[model samples]
Target chain A: MKLAIMGVGAVGRSVVDLAPDYGHVVTAVADSSSAAVDPSGIDVDAVFDRKERGGVVGSGDPEDALDAEYDVLVEATPTTLGDAEPGFSHVRAALERDRHAVLANKGPVAERYGDLMALERESEGTVQFEAAVGGAIPILSTIADFGPSQISAARGVLNGTANFVLSRMAAEGLGYEHVLAEAQDLGVAEADPAFDVDGTDAALKFVILSNVLSQGERVYSLEDATVEGIRDIPASALDLAAEDGRTVRLIGEATADGVRVGPRLVPQHDALAVSGTRNIVQFETVNAGQLHLSGRGAGGPETATAILSDVGRLE
Target chain B: MKLAIMGVGAVGRSVVDLAPDYGHVVTAVADSSSAAVDPSGIDVDAVFDRKERGGVVGSGDPEDALDAEYDVLVEATPTTLGDAEPGFSHVRAALERDRHAVLANKGPVAERYGDLMALERESEGTVQFEAAVGGAIPILSTIADFGPSQISAARGVLNGTANFVLSRMAAEGLGYEHVLAEAQDLGVAEADPAFDVDGTDAALKFVILSNVLSQGERVYSLEDATVEGIRDIPASALDLAAEDGRTVRLIGEATADGVRVGPRLVPQHDALAVSGTRNIVQFETVNAGQLHLSGRGAGGPETATAILSDVGRLE
Candidate 1:
C-alpha cells in the first residue's frame, strides 16, 4: 500500500518509518505547515532529519501531500473535540478521492461517526480507526470479527495517565499532586494533562466503542457519556479500598444503552487493576461469556502499528 | 452456510442448537454410533431428544452424516491422540470433497496440523481450529490478524480444569489432591482427569498454538512440548507464593523456540493469574508490546461459539 500521512507527530513518524517493514510505502507526509510528496516513496530518514533541524517537513503546502497519489490516507493528527475539524476534512478529502482512510486520530470517529459513515457509504473508500481506542490492542477488529451484536458490554481502564496516577497512588501511598508531577517529569503525562486526567480522553474512546457496539442503531458522542475522572480520588480512598482487597481504576464502559467512564473499585487482583500505563478492556459476550484484552493503550509506535493493521485490513 | 457436525457431544449439540441464531443451518449430525442426515436442515431439538432417550442421534450409520452434503464440516468428535483418528479422517473426507472444516476436536490439530494443511492445499477447503485452542478466547484469530511473524511470544493459563484446581488450591490453601477431588465433584474435572490435570490438555492447546505461531515453518505435536502438570503443586507452595503476593498457575509459553507447560508463579494481580475456570493468553508482539487476552477457555457453548466464529470466517 502507498500511504500519505497527515501529521508529523510521533505516530505519523513511526508509521512512515515502519511502513516498508510491513510491505508498504509512504508516498507523502504532511506536518501542520509543510508537506513532502514523492510519487514512488518518500525518503523517511530525510524527512525526519529535516523536521529535526527545521520546523517544516518539506518545502510545500500541507495540502499538496493531501492531494498526493496514495492508496490510503493515515490520519495521525492530534485529537480534537466537537466538529473534529481539519482531521474530519482530511478524511473527507481522502474518501472523496475514492481512497481509504485509516485513522489514529480519535476526533473524527468519536465526535462525528455518523457523518463519517455517511461519507463512507457514498464513496469507494472505507474507514478504520482501531488506533482511536486501544492503541495496539486489536479490540476494534476483534469486535468486527465477532459480530458487534454478540458483544453485550465493554468496560476497561483506557486512560494511561489516569491509571498511572491511581496505581502509583495506590502502590506508594502518594497524593495525586505528587504523582501527577512525577508523571510529568517522567514524560508519562503531558504538560497539561487535563484531557486525560479529566476523563475526556477515555470517554472519547468509550464513545467510539459505544458507536461501534450500537451498530449504527444509535450514534454516541462525547456528550452522551457519563464521565468522571480520577482528579478527585484521594490517596486515602486507595488505602480504604486496599483494606478490603480492592483497588481503584479509571474504568470506561460501553453498553447497548450508554457509555460511562469513572473511577471504579475493582478487586486488587482483578485483570482490570493493571499497574502503570497498561490498559485492559473486558467484553461481556453473549455466548462466549467475558473476554478481556489488555495492552499498551497509547504510544507513538504502538498506535502506528494499529494504523498499519487497519491499512492491512482495507480491501 | 450448511454445516455437517461429526459429534453429538456437548459442543456439537450446542453448535446444532445455536446454528440458526448465527444464520446457519445444520444439515447433518453424527454421534459415535448413529447419524442424522438432512439435505436442507435437521430438527435440532428432535435430534437431542432422540439422543437423550434412545442413546442415538438418528437411525443412520455415522458414515452417512460424513457423506451428507454440506458447505462446512464441523468436526466436534471426541479427540483421539495417536493418528488423531476418526476426527482426522472426518476432516480429510470433508476436504477431499472440497468442504471447509471447522474443528472443536484438538487431536487432529494438535497432532496432525501439517497433514491437515497438506490436505487443505490439495483441496479447495481450508481448516480452522479456534475451538481447539482457547474455546471462546479468539486467540487464534487474533494471532492470524496480527500476522504470525509479528508476534514474538505467547504465554498464558489455558486449561480451565487445571486452572480451577490451581486457583482453588491457592485461594483455599488446600492440597492438590483435595482441590482435584472438589473439582471433579463439581464437574469441573472429568472422572478420569489425567488428560487435563496431567497437563496434556494444556500442552495440546499450546502445541496447536505453537504450530500456528510458527506459520508452518515448523509443526509441533504433543510429544514435542515439555509438559508439567499442577499435580505436584502442594498447599505449602501456594502459601509460599501468597506470602510474596504471587500465585501458581499452569502457565504455557510458546515462542519460535519451543513450547513449555508447567506450574509457574505469576503476580497475584497479573492478568495471567485469572481465577477459576477462566483462561488467559498473553502475546508479545514485535511492535505492539505485550497483549493479554482472557476469557472462558472451555465449555460446550463457549467452544461452540468459537466454532461458529470460524464458520463465519470461511469464504
Candidate 2:
C-alpha cells in the first residue's frame, strides 16, 4: 500500500524504516517545515536520513501530503495534543479522503475519539489507534475489534512514567523523588512528566478504551471519571509492599462501573511484580479470566515500531 | 444471529451463558452424551461459573443441531485430529450447509487448516477459532484482520498447562511428577498431557497464527520445527534462575524461518515472566510490536466465553 508519514520524529522514523520490511511503499513524509515524496521510492526509503543525524522532517509542508495519492496516513508527532489542531486536522482530511488513518498521535484519538471514530466510520475507512494507547501493545485493537466478542475488563499500568517511578522505588528501595529524578535522568520519565504522574496519560488511554468497549457513537465524561494521580503514592508504601511480598503499580483499570484509573499496591503473586520501566496490560474475560501482558512501553524505536505495526492494518 | 452449539462442555456452556450479554440467540446444543441448551439469557456475567447446573436441550442426536436452522455454529469438542476422522468433520458438514463455524477446537485446524480455509473461501463463511489456542486472547483475529498493516513476529506462551506447571514448579519448588500428579488431580492438565508438556500444543497454535501472520497457507512440521518440551527442564534450573532474579517459562515462539516451540528460561524483567496459568499467548507485530494477552487456556466456561465471543463478532 502507499503509506505516507505525518512526521519524522522517533516514531515516524521507525515507521519509515519498517515500511519496506512490511512490503509497503513509504510515498511521502510530512512535518512542520518540510514535506517530501519520492515516486522512485528513494527519498521515501531514505528520508529518515535527516532524522538519523538528530533532525526531524524539517522542511515538509503538511499540505503536500494532500496532493500525494496515499492510501494510509500515519500520524506520529511530539504529542502537542492541545496545540495539535494542525496534525489532527491533517489526519482528519486524509480520513475524509477515504484514506485510513493509523494514529500514533495521542491527541486525535485521546481527546476526540468519538468524533474521529465517527468520521472513520462515515468514510468507510479505519482510524487504527493501537500505538496511541499502549505504545506497541495492541491494547486498543484488543479492546475494540477483539472486544465485541472477548473483553470483559481492560486495565493496566497504562502510563509508563508512573510505572517506571513505582517500579524503581519498589526495586531499589528509593524514595519517590529520588526515583523520579532517576527516571527522568534515564529517560524513563519525561522532563516534565505531569501528564503521566498525574494519571492524565492513563486517563486519555482509558477514554479511547471506553469507547471501544462500549461500541457506541462515542464515550465522553465531562464529569471527570475518577482520575487519580500517581504522584501522591508514598515511597514508603512501596517499600512496605516490597517487604511484604507485594509491588506498587500505577494501575488504570476499567470495568462495567465506569472506570478506575489509579495506582494500586498489587501483591507480588500478581504479574505486576514483574513490572519494570515497561508497560504491562492485562485482559480479563469470562474465558481467559485474568491474562497478563508486559513489554517495553516507552522507547523511540519501540513507539515507532508500534506506528509501523499499525500502518500494516491502517495503511 | 441464531447460534447452535456442538459439544456443550465448559466452553459451550460459557458461550450459552454469555449469549444474553451480547444480545444473541443460542438455539440448540449438540453434545456426545447429553445434549442440552436453553434460549433464556445467561443470568450473571462472570469469568467462570464454578457451578455445573444449566438448562439443557436435545438428548436425541447430533443431527438435531443441523435441523435447528441456525446462522452460526459453535464447535467446542475435545481435540480430534492426527487420528481417524476428527469431529471437525461434523464442523465441515455444517460449513457445507453455509453456516459460519466458531471452533474452539484446534484439531482440525492443526491438521487441515488449509483445507478448511479453502472450504471457507469457497463457502464465503467463517471458521473462527478464537478458543482453539488461548481462550479469549484474540491472537488470531488481530493477526488476520488488522495485521495487514504492521505485523512482524508471532510469538508468545501459547500453552497454559505448560505455563501453570512451570509456575508451580518454579514458584513453589515442586518436582515434575508431583506437579503432574497435582495438575491431573486438580483437573488442570489433560489426561495425556503430551500436547501441553511437549511443544505439540504450541506447534498447532502456530499453524493458526501463521495463517494470519503471512496470509498464506500454514506450512509446518512437528518434526522439522524446533520442538522442546518443558519436562526436560530441572526444577533446580528454575531455582538457579530465581537466585539470579529471573524466571523460567515455556515460550512457544514462531518467527520467519520456522518456529521455536518449546520451553525457554527468560529474565524476570521480561514480559514472559508475567504470563501465568490459563493465561496469554501474545503476538508481537510490526505495528503493535508486543501484545501480551492472558486467559483460560482450556475448560468448559472459558471455552464457552471464547465461542460466544466469536458469536458476538459474527453479529
Candidate 3:
C-alpha cells in the first residue's frame, strides 16, 4: 500500500522506517512544518538524517502530504484534547478522498468518534486505530473479531508511565515524585507527564474502548470519564497493600455504564499486578469468562507496529 | 450461516444453544450413536430432552448428519490422536462439499493440520479452530491478525486441569495426588486426567500453535513435542518456588525451532502465573515485544464461544 504519514516524531518516523518491511511504501512524509512527497517512495534514511540535523523532512508544506497520492493515510501526530485538530482534519481529507486512514493519534478517536464514524459512513474509506489504545496489543481487532456485544467489560493498566511509578514505589519504597523523576531521567516519562500521570491517557484509551463496546449506541469523551491518578499514592500505601498480598495499579475500566480510571488494589500475584512498565487489560466476556491481554503499553516502535497492523487490516 | 454440529457433547450442546444468539442456526447435530438432521433449524431443546431420557437424538443415522445441508460444519467430537478419525472425515466431508468447517475437536488440528489445510485449499470453504487451542482466549485469532510470521515465539499455560493441579498444590501446599483428587471431585479435572496431567493435552495445543506459527512451512504433532506433566511436581517444589518469589506452571512453548510442554518456574507475579483454571499465553513479537493473552483455557461454554467466534469470522 502507498502511505502518507503525518508527523515526523517517534511513532511516525518508526512507521516510515518499518513500512517497507510490511510490504508498504511511503509516498509522503510530513511534520508540522514540512513534508516530502513522491509518487514512488520516500528515502527513509535521508529523511531521518535531515530531521536529526535539525532540518525539515522536505521542501513542501505539511498539508501537501495529506493531498499526496496514497492508498492509506497514517495519522501519527501527537494527541490533542478537544478539537483533535490537524489530525482530525488530516483524517477527514483522506476519507473525503476515499482513502483509508490508520491512526496512531488518540485524539480523533477518543474525542470525536461520532464525527469520525459519520465521515467513514459517507466515504468508501475505512478508519482503524489499533495503535490508539494499547500499543502493539491487538485489543481492537480482538474486540472486532468477537463482536463488541460479546464483551461485558474491559479493565486494565493502560499507561506505562503511571504503572512504572507505582510499581517502583512498591518495589523500592520510594515516593511518587522520586519515581517520576527517575522515569523522566530514563526517558520513560515525558517532560510534561500530566496526561499520563493524571489518568487522562489511560482514561482516553478506556473511553475509546467504551465507544467501541457501545457500537454507536452512545459516544464517550474525556468528560464522561471518572479519572483518578497515582499522584497522591505514597510509599506507605504500597507497604500497606503489600502486607495484605496486594498492590496498587492504575486501573482503567470501560463498561456499558461508563468509564473510570483510578489506582486500585489488585492481588500481589494477580495478572493485573504486572511489574515495571508492563500493562495488562482484563476483559469480562459473556460466555467466555474473563480474558486478559498484556504487553508494552507504549513505545515508538511498538506503537508503530500497531499502526502497521491497522494499515494491513484496511481493505 | 447454517451450522451442522457433529457432536452432542458439552461443547456441541453449548454451540447449539448459543447459535441463535449469534444469528446462526444449527441445522443438524449428532453424537457417536445417533444423529438429528433437518433442512430447517433443529429443535435443540427436544434433542437434549431426548438424549437425557436415554433415547437417540433423532431417527437418523450418525452418518446422515455428515451429509446434511449446512453452510458450516462444526466438529465438536472427542479429540483423538492417530488419524484424527471421524472428526477429520467430518471436516473433509464439509470442505469437499465446499462448506466451512469450524472445529472444537483438537484432533484434526493438532494431529493432522497439513491434511486439513490441503482439503481447505482445494475447496471453496475456509477452516477455523480457535477452540482447538486456548478455548475462549482468542489466541489463534490474535495470531492470525498479526500474521504468524510476525510472532517470534509463544509460551503459556494451555491446560486448565494441569494448571488447577499446580496452582492448588502451590496455594494449599498439597501433594499432586491430593490436588488431582480434589480437582476431580470438583469436576475441574476429568476422572481420567491422563491427557492433561501427563502433558499430552497442553502438548497438543502447543503443537497446533506451532503448526499455525510455521504457516505451513512445517507441520507439528504430539510426537514432535517434548512433554512433561505436573504429576512429578511436589508441594516441596512449590514451597521452594514461593521462597524465590516464583511459582510452577505447566508451560507449553511453540517456536520455529520446536514445541515443548513441561512444568516450569515463573515469577509469581508474572502474567504466565495465572491461577485457578485461568490460562495465559505469551507471544514474543519481533517488534511489539512480549504480548500475553489469558482466559479460561477450557470449559464447555468457553470453548463453544470460541467456536462461535470462528464461525462469525467465516466468509
Candidate 4:
C-alpha cells in the first residue's frame, strides 16, 4: 500500500519506521519541522513540492502529494481543537482528496465526528482511529462488529503521563512535584503536558468512543463525564486505594447518556491496576459483559503499529 | 444467507428459534431425539429425509444434510473426542461440498484445527467459532489479529455453572450439595452436571484457545493445565477471598508451553469476579498486558447469536 504520513512526530515517525514490515511504501512525507522535509531524504520514494500557501505541512500541499496517488492518509500531528488552522484541517484536506484517513490525531474526530463520518459515508470509506484511542489495543474494531449491543459501560485509565505520576506517588510515597519532575526527565511528560495532565486528552478520547458506540450526532461534553485530574489527590489517597486492594489511576467512565472521567481508586486485582505505562480502556456490556483491554496507550512504535494496521485497508 | 444448523439441541434450537430475525432459511433440522425426528414434520424452508439413527437428530441422516445445497453450515452438536464420528465427519462433509462453517461444536476444531484449517485454506473460506469457547464474547476474533507479541498467561472465571454454584455458596454461606441442589433446581446445573462441575468442559475450552492463539499444530493435554474443580476448595475459602476483598471463581490460565485451568479467588473489583452465567475468558498478553474478556460462556440463544453474527460471509 502507498501511504503518506502528515508529520514526523512521535506517532508519525513510528509509522514510517514500521512501514517496511507491513508492506507499506512511504511515497511522501510532510511535517512543519524543516528537518523532517528535505530535497534528498535519507530513504524515500519521493519528496513533495511544498505548496507555498500555508504553515500546516499537509494542509498546504495536499495537491502536491495527490499527483503521486497515495492510497492511505495517516494524520498523526499534534491534537488541537476549533476552526483555527490545526491538524484537523489537514485531516479534512486528506479526506477531501478521496484518501481514507487513519487518524492518530484527536482534535479532528473528537471535535467533528459527524463531519468526518459524513465525509467517510460520502466517499464510501472508513476513517479508522483505533490508534487514536487505545494505541495498539484495537478497541474500536472490537466494538464495531464483535461488541455491538454488548457494551454497557466503558471505563479505564487513558492518560499515561498522568497515570505514571499517580502510580509513582502511590507506589513510592512521593509528592506530585517529585513525580512530575521524574515524568518530565524521562520524556514521558510533554513540553507542556497540560492536555494529558488536565484530563482533556482523556475526555476527547472518551467522546470519540461514545460517538462510535452510541447513536445521535451530538458530541459528548467533558463536563458530562465527572473528570478529575490526578494532580490534586494527595499521596495518602494512593495508600488508601492500595489498602482496599485498589490502585489510583485516571479513569474514564462513559454511559449511554453521560460520561465520568477522573482519577479512580480501582482495585488492584482488577485489570485496570495491572495496566502499565500509557493506559487501559475497559468496556462492560450486557451480553458480552466486562472486558479489560490494556496496551501501550501511547508511544511511537505502538502508535505507529496502530496506524499501519489499517493503512493496508485503504484499498 | 441460507443457513442450516445440524443439531437441534440447545444451541441449535436457539439458532432455529432466532432464525426469523437474522434472515436464515432453515432448509433442514436434524437430531437423534424423538422430537427432532418426529412425524408431525419439521417446519422449515424444506425438510430433508427423516429417520433417527443415533441419540441426536439431524437431516434424517448427517450425510444427507451435507449433500444439500446451503450457503453455510453451523455444526453445533455435543463434543466427542478421538473417533470424529459425527461432528468431525459432518464438518468434513461440509468442507468437501465447499460450504462455509460457523462451528459451535468443539469436537472437530479442538482435535482437528490443523486439518480443518488446511481444508478451509484450500477452499478459500473462513471458519469462525467464537461460541465454541466464550459464548457471546469475541475473544477468538480478538486474538485472531492480536497485537501482543505473545500471550503470557490468560486466567479468569471460564465456567458459569461452576461460578454460579460457587457464588451461591459464598452469598448464602451454603455447602456444596445444598448449592448444587439449588443450581440443579435453577436449571443451570444439569441433572448429571459432570462435564461442567468437573474441570473437563473448561479444559476443552482452554485447549481450543491455546491452539487458536499459538501458531503450532500442537494440541493441549489435560495435564498441561491443572484442572481443579470448585469442589476442591471448601466454601470457607470464600471467606478468605472476601476478607481480602476478592471472589473465588473457576479460572483457566493459558501460558507459553501449556495452560493452567482452575478456580481462582479473583478480587471483587476484578473483571473475573463480575463474570456471571455460562463462561468468561480473559487473556494476559505480553504486548497489550492483561485483557479481561467476559460473555455468556454458555447458553442457547446467546450461542446462536454468536453463529448468526458470523453469517454475513457464511458462504
Candidate 5:
C-alpha cells in the first residue's frame, strides 16, 4: 500500500519505520513546516537520518504531502479540540480524494464522527482509526465486530499519564504534585499535562468510543462529558479505599445515560485497576457479558502498530 | 442470510432465538438424532416448541441437514478429541460445498486447523470460530487485526469450570474436590468434568489461539501442549500464594518456544487473575506490547453471540 503521512512526529516516524514490514510504503512525508513527496516512494531511512541531525523532513509545504499520489493518508498530528482542524481537514481531504484515511489523531473522530462517517459513505475509500483511542488494544474493532446495539456500555482507564499518577500515589503514598513532578521527569506526563491530569484526554477517548458504541446515534463531545481529574486525590482517600480492598482509578465510562470521566473506586483486583501507564477498556455486551481489553494506551511505536493494522484491514 | 444449524444444543438454540435480531434465518437445523431441512427457512419458533418437549429438532436423518441448501453452516456440536469427527466432517462438508462454516465446536479447530484452513483456501467460503475459544471475547478476531507475525506470545485463563473451582477454593479455603462438587451442583461443571478440571479445555483454547497467532505458519494441537489439572491444589497452597500478593491460576501460554498449560502464580491484581467462570486472553504483541481480553468463556447466550458475530462477518 502507498501512504502519505501528515505530522512527522513520534507516531508518524515510527509508521515510516514499520510500514515496509507490513508491505506498505510512504509516498510522502510531512512535518509541521515542510513535506517530501514522491510519486514512487519516499526514502524513509534517509528522511529519518536527516531529521535525526536536526533537519526538516522535506522542503515543500505540509499540504504537499496531503495532495501526493497515495492510496491512504495517515493523520498523526497532535490533537486539538473545537473544530479539530488540520488533522480533521487532512482526513476530510483524503476521503474527498477517494483515498483511505488511517488516523493516529483522535481529534477528528472524537469531534466529527458523524460527518467523517457520512463522508466515508460517499467516498470511494473508507476510514479507520484504531490508533485514535487505545493504541494497539483493538477496542474499536472489537466494538465494530459486536455492532453498536449489542453493546450496552463501554468503560476503561484510557489516559496513561493520569493512571500512572494515581497508581504511584496509591503505591508509594505520595502526593499528587510529587507524582506529577516524577511523571513529568520520567516523560510520562507532558510539560503542560492539563489534558491528561484534568481528564480531558480520557474524556476524548470515551467520546470516540461512545460514538462507536452508539453507531453514531449519539454524539458525545468533551463538553457533553462530566470530567474530573486526579489532581485532588488525597493519600487518606487511597488508604481508606485500600481498607475495603479497593483503589481509586481515573475511569472513563459511557452508558445510555451519558459519558463520564472521574476518579472512581475500583476493586484492587479488578482488570480496570491496572497500575502505571497501562490502560484498559471494558465493554458490557448484552450477550457477550463483559469484555475487557488492556494494553499500553500511548506510545509512538505502539500507536504506529495500530495505524499499520488499520492499513492492513484495507486489504 | 440463510443458515443451517447442525446442533440443537444450548448454543444452537440461542442462535435460533437471536438470529432474527441480526437479520439471519435458520434454513435448516439438526440434532444427533434428527434433522430439519428447508430451502426457504425453518420455523424457528416451532422448532423451539418441539425441542422444549424433549423431542429431536427434526424428523429427518442428521445427514439430511448437512446436505441441505444454506449460505452458511453453523457447527455447534460438542467437541471430541483425536479425529474431532462429526464436527470436523460437518465443517469439511460445508467448506467442500463452498458454504461458510461458523463453528461453536472447538474439536475441528483444535485438532485439524491446517486441514480446515486448507479446505477454506480451495473453497469460496471462509471459516470463523470465535466461539471455539473464549466464548464471546473476540480473541481470535483481535489477534487477526494485529496479524500473526506482530504477536510475540499469548497467555490467558481460558476455562470457566476450572477457574470457578479454583476461585471457590481460594475464597472459601475449601478443597478442590469439595469445590468441584459444589460447582457440579451449581451446574458450573459437567458431571464428568475431566476435560474442564484436567486442563484439556484451556489447553484446547490455547492451541487454537496459537494457530491463530501464527497464522497457519505454526500448528499446535492438544497433543503438542503440556497440560496439568487443578485437582491437586490444596487450600494451603492458595493461602501461601496469597501471602506474596499473588494467586495461582490455570494459565495457558503459547510463545515461540512452545505451548503449555498448568497452574502458575499470578499477581492477585493481574488481569488474568479473574475469578469464577470468567476467562482472560492476553496477547503480547511486538509493537502493541501486551493486550488483555477477558469475558465469560462459556454459556449458551455468550457462545451464541460469538457464532452470530462470526456469521455477521460473512457479510
Candidate 6:
C-alpha cells in the first residue's frame, strides 16, 4: 500500500521505519513545518536523517503531501480539542477522495466521529483509528469483532503517565508531586504534563471508545466526561488502600449514559491494577463476560504498531 | 444471513438462541441422529422444545442440513482425534459448495488446518474458528489484526477446567484430587475430564493458535506438544510457591519451533495468573510488546458468543 504520513514525531517516525518491514511503501511525508512528496515512494531514511541533523523534512508545502498519490493517509499529529483542525480536515479530504484514512491522532475521532461517519457515507473509503485508544492493544477491533451492542461498558487505565504516578505513589509511599517529578525525569511524563496528569488524555481515549461502543450512534468529547486527576491523591490514601489489599488507579470508564475518568480503588490482585506505565482495558459483555486487555498504552513503536494494523485492515 | 448448525449441544443451542438477535436466521439444524432443513428459516424454538422433550432435534437425514440453502455452516460437534473426521468432511463440503464455515469443533482445526486452508484457496468462501480456542477472548482475531509475522510467540492459560482446579487448590490449600472433585460437583469439569485435566485441551488450543500464527506454514497436533498435567501438584508445592509470592497456572505456549502445555509458576500479581475458571492469553509481538488478554475461556454461552462473532464476520 502507498502511504502519506503526517506528523514526523516519534510515532510517525516509527511508522515510516516499520511500514516497509510490513510490505508498505511511504509515498509522502510531512512534519509540522515541512513536507516531502513522491508519487513513487519517499526516501524515508533521508527524510529521517534530515530531520535529525537540524534540517526540515522537505521544502514542499504540507498540502502537497495531502494531495499526493496514496491509498491511505496516516494522521499522527498532536491532538487538538475544538474543531480538531488540520487533522480533521486531512481525514475529511482523504475520505472525500475515496482514500482510506488511518489515524493515530485522537482529536478527529473523539470530537468529530459523527461527522466522519457522515463523510464515509458519501465516500468510497473508510476510516480506522485503533491507535486512538489503547495503542496496540486492539481495543477498537475487539469491540468491533464482538459487535457494539454486546459490550455494556468499557473501563480502563488509559493514560500511562497518570498510571506511572499512581503506581509509584502506591509502591514507594511517595506523594503525587514526588512521583510526578520522578516520572518527568524518567521521560514518562512530558514537561507540560497537564493533559495526562489532569485526566484529559484518559478522558479523550474514553470519548473515542464511547463513540465506538455506541457504534457511531453517539459522539462524545472531553467536555462530556466527568474528569478527575491523580494530582490530589495522597500517599496516606495509598497506605490506607493497601491496608485493605487495594490499589488506587486512574480509571477511565465509558458506558451508554456517560464517560468518566477518575482515581478509583481496584483490588491489588485485579488484572486492571497493572503497575508502572502499563494500561489495561476491560469490556463488560453480556454473553462473552468481561474481556480484559493490558499493554504499554503509549510509545512510538507501540502506537505505530496499531497504526500499521489499521493500515492492514484497509486490505 | 441464512445459517446451518451441525450440533444440538449447548454451544449450538446458544447460537440458535442468539443468532436471530444478530439478524441471522437458522435455515437448518442437525443432531447426531436427526436433521431439519428449511430454505426460509427453521423454527429454532420448536427445535429446542423437541430436544428438551426427549426427542432428537429433527427427523430428516443429516446430509439434508448440509445441502440446504445457507450462507454459512456452524460446526459444533464433539471433537475427536486421528482423522478429525465428520467435522473435517463437513467443513470441506461447505467450502466445496462456496459456503463459509465457522467451526466450534477443535478436532478439524487442530489436525486439519492446512487441508482446510487448501480448501479455502479453491473455494469461494473462508473459514473462521475463534470458538475453537480462548472462547470469547478474541485471541485469533487479535493476532490476525496484528499480522501473524509480527508476533514472536503466544502464551496463555487456555483451559478453564485446568485453571479452575489449579486456582482452587492454590486458594484453599487443597490437593488436586479434592479440588477436581469440587470442580466436578460444581459442573465446572466434565465427569471424565481427562482431556482437560491432563493438558490435551490446552495443547490442542495452542496447536490451533500455532497454525494460525504461522499462517498454516506449519501444522501442529496433540502429538507434537510437550504436555504436563496438574494432576500431581501437591498442596505443599502451592504453599511453597506462595512464600515467594508466585502462583501456579497451566500455561500453554506456541513458538516457531515448539508448542507445550504444563504447570508453570507465574508471579502472583502477573496478569496471566488469573483465578478460578478464567483464562488469559499473551502475545509477544515485535512492535506492540507483550499484549495480555484475559477472560472466560470455556462455557456454553462464552464459546457460542465466539461462534456468533464469527458469523457476524462472514458479512
Report the error of model 3 at residue A275, Å. Answer: 1.7
| lDDT tens per residue, model 5, B1-315 | 899998888898888888988998788999888887878888877777777786877778999988998989999999999899899999989999999999999998999988888999999999999999999888888878888889889898999999999888877889888999999999999999999999999999989888887777778789999999998899999999988998889999988877799999998777788999999888888877888888888999999999998999998
lDDT of each: 0.91, 0.69, 0.91, 0.68, 0.89, 0.90
Model 2's DockQ score: 0.39
Residue-level lDDT tens digits of model 2 in A1-315: 888787777777777777786678877887776777765453753556775564555355667765677888888866655435766787788878988788777777666666777787879567777777777666665555445445677777778778778877777788888988988888777888897898877877776666677776347441345888877777788778878878877777666676668777788757655455667777676445665656667666667666666665554
Calculate DockQ per candidate and list them. 0.80, 0.39, 0.83, 0.28, 0.86, 0.92
For model 5 chain B, give the 10-residue run with minimal summed lDDT.
B45-54
**Model 4, span A1-315: residue lDDT tens:** 777677767787777767876666776677754322322222542222232343344433544543445677788878776631456666666677777778898877777777777777777446888788878676776676543455667888777888888878877988887888888999988777788888888888887788777755356544445566767888887788788878878887677767667876776655676433656777775543455566678878777766876664454
The superposed Cα distance between candidate 6 and the true structure at residue A200, in angstroms, equals 0.1
**Per-residue lDDT of candidate 6, residues A78-110 (tens digit):** 999889988999898898889999998999988
Query: Which runs of model 4 end up more than 4 angstroms from their true locations?
Result: A34-69, A84-86, A147-153, A162-191, A215-253, A258-286, A312-315, B17-27, B34-69, B122-125, B147-157, B161-189, B216-256, B259-290, B313-315
Candidate 5 lDDT for residue A47: 78
Best by DockQ: 6
What is the C-alpha RMSD, rounded to one decimal, of candidate 3? 1.3
- Please identify model 3 stretches exceeding 4 Å from their true place: none
Question: What DockQ class does candidate 2 belong to?
Answer: acceptable
Candidate 5 displacement at residue A97 in angstroms: 1.0
What TM-scores do the predictions have?
0.98, 0.81, 0.98, 0.77, 0.97, 0.98
Q: What is the lDDT of residue A293 in candidate 1?
A: 91
Off by over 4 Å in 6: none
Q: Please report how far candidate 2 places residue B310 from its true position, in Å.
A: 3.5
Query: Which segments of model 5 are wrong by more than 4 Å?
Result: none
Superior by TM-score: candidate 3 or candidate 4: 3
List, residue by residue over B84-187, the lDDT tens digit for candidate 4: 45787777767777777888887677767777778877764467787787777666766655532445566666677888888887777788889899889989
